[model samples]
Target: MIQNRSLARRGAAVVAAGAAALVLAACGGDGDSDSSAGHGGHKATASASASSSASASASQGQRNAADVAFAQGMIPHHRQAVEMAGLASGRAQSAEVSKLAADIRKAQDPEIKTLSGWLTSWGEDVPAKGAMDHSAHDMGGMMTDGEMTELENASGKAFDTAFMKLMIKHHEGAVEMAKTEQADGAYGPATRMAGEIITSQSAEIEQMNKLLGKD
Candidate 1:
């Protein structure tokens, strides 16, 4: 009877050991499942971040019709101003007038290049250099061919006065156009440029008016 009881006790111990091993195996399986879930969540978060980055990039690149119009119109306008400014080298009487012409040329030349680059990036055609003759006739503050020719023939004080008058008018038109761009354009850089144009050219207008004794 003692031997029988010893065998029964040994059997009970074996069953208890089996139960503990099963519990440990179930806990290990749960840990593995949790680890796999955590890894999957990380991958999903990474994918979402990549998608958000792409969306932001696309937003930055987007353009509207008004942006295209602003670039196209401003390029030719800047080019004409540069051309007029180029004629001031030896003809202008006042040092201030000559300096102003130089500034206009310096500022507008690079702006023309930037405008052209924007057009090219947008897959739009840049205005040909010779197109200004036809287009300028209708644009506000643009000088007619006869007026340009008359200024070209003028000298000394006459040239300075004519240059300032024409430039003031030209700057006014640019300011108006820039205002339109600021109001209607969707491109961030282009709108910012428009604001700059308005500020700088308005100041120049005031300067020119004072120079003309009209302020």
Candidate 2:
């Protein structure tokens, strides 16, 4: 009887030891699975962040190209118009014509300054101080030195008539140039200015035509 009881107690202790070992093995497997899951989550987050940063960089590069072209083209165009406006101030005879020239000079000079600043900020060159090749015939409403001299020498109604005629043609040419930029230019600000020029100059051209009829 005593031997049988000792045997039963030893059997119970062996079973308990086996159960404990099984429990420890299960805990170790669960810990490994959790660690692997954490590593995978970290990798996914890193990949997402890298993709987002690349997209932002590409968008900014596109905007930069547009801004640069707008500043470069518009500066030269505005400069020529301002030169023409200056001629009008001294040569125009009618009070209305003189007022129009003054307004054009005032509006365009400040715009020139603004465009110059944009070019500087973009690290682009401002248009140099020379006449651009603006004509296929060398007479696309562009006043040569001789033509300007002729206008400058005239007085009274003749001056007014000549100035209005020249300016009407000049504005037409500017409108054409602005249309080109609006169609093909890349930057938002530049394209917008080009549209404005087309609208305003077209209206002025009509006014100048009326002035022509008066004479």
Candidate 3:
């Protein structure tokens, strides 16, 4: 009878060991499932974060019609300013006026390229490079062919005076366009350019007035 009781106890121990092994296996599977689920969740979150970032970047640089117009109009306008500046050295008498012309050329030339680049990137039309006829466009500060011709014909102090008068008007026109962009343009870079034009050219206008002895 003692031997039979010993056998029964052994059988019970075997059953208990098997049950414990099964429980451990089940727990291990649960752990693996939880780990896999956590990894999947992380991947999903990363994908969502990446998508949101791309969306934000695209939206921030988006342009409107006003922005397009501002860029397009400014390109030719800046070109004209650069052209006018080029004419100053041979004709202008005032050292200050000559320096101012050089400065205007240096500043607006790069800005013209920048504005053109913006339009190209936006899939918009870049203004044609040439003697742009401003008659058709409502851009402010545009010099007529006659005005430019007249200025070109002048010499010495006469040229300096004409340059100052024309440039002041040109700067005023740029200011008007810039203010319009500041109010209505949607592209961040273009609008900022507009504001810079207003600030810088307005100061230049004041300087031109001084050059003209009007300030």
Candidate 1 Cα RMSD after full superposition onto the native fold (Å): 2.7
Highest TM-score scorer: 1
Full candidate order by lDDT, most accurate first: 1, 3, 2
Model 3 lDDT tens row, 1-215: 99999999999999999999999999999999999999999999999999999888766688899999888888888888898899987788889999999999999999998998888888999988884764524579888888889988998999998988999998999999999999998888888888899999999999989877786
As a whole number from 0 to 100, the lDDT of residue 10 in candidate 1 is: 100
Kindly indicate the candidate among 1 and 3 with the higher TM-score. 1
Cα-based TM-score, every candidate: 0.85, 0.64, 0.83
Worst 10 residues of 2 by lDDT: 133-142
Full-model lDDT for every candidate: 0.89, 0.72, 0.88
Better TM-score candidate (1, 2):
1
TM-score of 1: 0.85
Candidate 3: list runs displaced more than 4 Å: 2-22, 48-52, 131-137
Kindly report which residue pairs in candidate 1 clash with one another: none
* Clash count of each predicted structure: 0, 0, 0
Sorted on TM-score, highest at the top, how do the candidates line up?
1, 3, 2
Residue-level lDDT for 48 in candidate 3? 100
